[model samples]
Target: MKVLVVGSGGREHALLWKAAQSPLVTALYAAPGNPGMEALAERVPWDGDLEALAEFAEREGIDLTLVGPEAPLVEGIADRFLERGLLVFGPTQRAAMIEGSKAFAKTLMERYGIPTARYRTFRDPILALEYLEEVGAPVVVKDSGLAAGKGVTVAFDLHQAKQAVANILNRAEGGEVVIEEYLEGVEATVLALTDGKSILPLIPSQDHKRLLDGDQGPMTGGMGAVAPFPMDEATQKQVEEGILKPLIQGLRAEGVLYRGVVYAGLMLTREGPKVLEFNARFGDPEAQAVLPLLESDLVELALRVAEGRLEGARPVWKPMAAAAIVLASPGYPEAPRKGIPLRIPEPPEGVLVFHAGTRLGPQGLETSGGRVLNVVGLGKDLEEALGRAYAFIPQIGFPGAIYRKDIGKKALRR
Candidate 1:
């Protein structure tokens, strides 16, 4: 089977790597893939152009097309490919609104009795500020639309919270902002593959979103992540039964046959697992950490979902723990300096580098974005995985590269 993976990031790179390992995969291609992915698949220059991607897939006789990002999915690429009788793995545009629009997702959760934070959406700055004053401090301000994963701000004080609201309501990029009651708890990400009926949950993973070490500074895409989190079996079951089941059933009842990956960003509060947000596709650093432990054939599973036969497929996973630490440019989640030369020494036996913001320059590999590469390490436990992950940081050469020294400290303490 010839496979075409879309997008250009660490997540896409990991997907490409996994797809290449499939024996059924005869040919592999990545559309506008990064430098790391070029080594795994035949790199193409289409950066998720719906029509061009569809045309290329049909012309190249690609057996399956897997989308890795949410932008193209929201642009109706899946529907376009399906119109041409091509097997595309992603949700339709209408269904993708669950991730595309924050307000829409929050409304869905409320209407379906899905537990989440108390939130209100506002478009006017004056009205929003008034609401903010009433709501008080220690809140979260989120951009209603995608901000490249840097839109959400968790303010610890009232002054910071008001500024966050002002930044979103007054900025040119920000339109409507969603202010929600802050829920303090352990944050975890649960991603599952669904056929609009049966949901197959992957191992739960936790991501460090803070830009600085010790979970300080502004929120970023994700600094690092660790899989097989310390959640008890009972808590995991509660999340599945209370959150995932209701979400899946609700979407189905709404006439949205949700197929593809569903990412539930959960805040494991004392009450239970309350969803913070929903991502239509896999999480970034979370994918970097989780995919390495998947023991099943990615190509077969994706094809089954595209064919609407996921009920017959059972995904398998490794018992080992996996951790991914992201290496970022000088200043991230803010002003990031680019064009810094990066020298990555030969990886250790079990470590893999999934490039995020990098390009093959004339000199060598250089920093191309805020987050550079995700260094992944696998081990029998979290400690062993984290040990291997942090060992390679010094070997990777990049000027002003910042990384969270304590990526999985929380889980380790638990």
Candidate 2:
């Protein structure tokens, strides 16, 4: 079967890699794919143009079209393809509001009694500041709309918290912002495949969101992540029951068939697993970490969901731990300096590099964006995996490249 994977990032690269292993796959294509994905699939230059993509798929007789980024999904690409009687693996535009609009998601969660942080939405700067002052320090400020994973700011002090609110509200177009009560706890990413019903959970993983070492600095897309996170069986069960199930049922009741990956960013607070946010598709670094441990056929599973036959198509996972550490250009989460040449040496055993913001230039790989390559390592445990991940970093040298030193430090302390 021929397939077209959309977007150009580490997540798309990983998807292309996994889908290529399927025996049924005959041809694979990536739209605007990065240099790393060039080896895995044929690279196309389309920037996720819905009509153009659909036309290309039809002309090429593509069997399935897999979306990679949130932009195309938010633009209702799935709905358009479905209208053309094409098979697509993503939720509809209406279903995508779970991630597109934070206010909408919060309302849904409240309606369903799903566990989450207390939050208030505001479009007015003055009212927002008043609420922030009332709520006190250590709150999270989030852009209601998509901001390329850099919109959410977890402020630790009153001054920073107020500034975050001001920055978001004072923007030119002034998008709605959410001020959330910060819940202290370990965070985990749980991605599941569903046909708007029968949910099949993937391996749980934790991501480090801070930009610097020792969990310092501002939030970023993700610095690193580890799969098969050390969550007690009881806590995992609580997340499934208290968070995932209610969410699925609520979406179903709302007549929204979410037939794709449901990514729940949860905080394992003392009260239980409270959702931080809901992403309609897979997480970036989390996808980089989790997909390596998946032993099941991803293409088959995705096809089942697209065909609405996911009842008996549970995915299998390996027992090993997989870690992904992201290497970023200088000044990430702010002014990132690009165009620096990168020198990546031979990867150590059990290590792989998935490119994110890189291009194969005349001089070799060059930094192209804030987050660059995702260096992945697999081992028996988190520490072993982290060691393998770090061992590859020094080999791949780039000027002013930054990464968190404490990739899996939380799991180590636990």
Candidate 3:
């Protein structure tokens, strides 16, 4: 079967890389894919047109189309393809509102009894600030609408909290904002495959969102990630039952046909696991780390989910651990410098390279976006995985490229 993977990022590259290993897939294509993906799949030129993509899928005899990013899913890419009777994996627009609108997600959680931080939505900045005064410091301020992953600010003080509120609403066209109490705990990601009915949870992974080491600096899409986060069985089970199950049941109760990966950004606090946010598709750097440890046939899994036939879809996972360290351009998650030459070598025996913001230019591969590449390492254990990944970081000559020195520090310490 021929398949099309959408988006251009490290996550998409990882998806295509895994899908290319499936013997069932006769051909592979990527829409607006990065140069790194060229080795595994044919790249298709696209202008981000949903309908046109559906038409292309129909024309190319693509058996299934799997989306890798949230923006297109929030814009109804899956719905568009379904409208053309083409099989696609992702949620419908209405279902995608869980990620598209923070305000909506908060309300849904409130209504469905999903464990989440205490929160309230505001349309007026003054009301938001007034609430800030009432709630005090150590809160999270968020743009109700999608702003990539940089939309959230975990403000430690009232001054920072108010500023976050003002910044989110002061966009060209003012927008809604959600202010919530910041839950203190370790954070981890749980991604599950669902047909809006049966839920199949994948291995939990942790992602580093801060741009600098030791969790300092602003939040980025993700700096790095490691699979099989060190969560006790009780906590891991709580995440699945307390968060994932209720999420799908709630969406179904709302009359939404949500079919795709359900990403739960969880804060595993003393009280229990509470959701920090929801994402419609797979997590970025997390995918780079987790997919490498998966032994199941991804193409077959996607096909079952797209067709809503996920009854006996038990995904198999390798016992190995995986780590992905992101190489970012200078000044990432703020102002990024572009066109810098990159010297990526043939990965060492155990490392895999996936590109995010890159282009094969006149001067060869150069940085094109904030996050440039994901260098993943697979090993017998998490420590070995991280060691292999860290040891190889310097060999890839990306001058001035920024990366976190402690990618798996959280799990290692635990």
Q: Report backbone clashes per prediction.
A: 0, 0, 0
Candidate 2 achieves a global lDDT of 0.88
**Using Cα atoms with residue i matched to residue i, what is each candidate's TM-score against the true structure?**
0.97, 0.97, 0.99
Worst 10 residues of 2 by lDDT: 312-321
lDDT ranking, best first: 3, 1, 2
RMSD of each candidate? 1.3, 1.3, 0.8
Residue 218, model 2: lDDT of 83
Q: How do the residues 227-334 of candidate 2 rate in per-residue lDDT, one tens digit apiece?
A: 888888898888778888888899889998888898999999888889999998989999999999999989999999999999977677887898899999988878
Query: For residues 19-103, what per-residue lDDT tens digits would candidate 1 score against the true structure?
Result: 9999999999999898888768898998556899899999999999989998988889989998999998888887788888898
What TM-score does model 1 achieve against the real structure? 0.97
Pairs clashing in candidate 2?
none
Which number leads on TM-score?
3
lDDT against the true structure, each candidate: 0.88, 0.88, 0.92
Model 1: lDDT equals: 0.88
Per-residue lDDT for 271 in model 3?
92
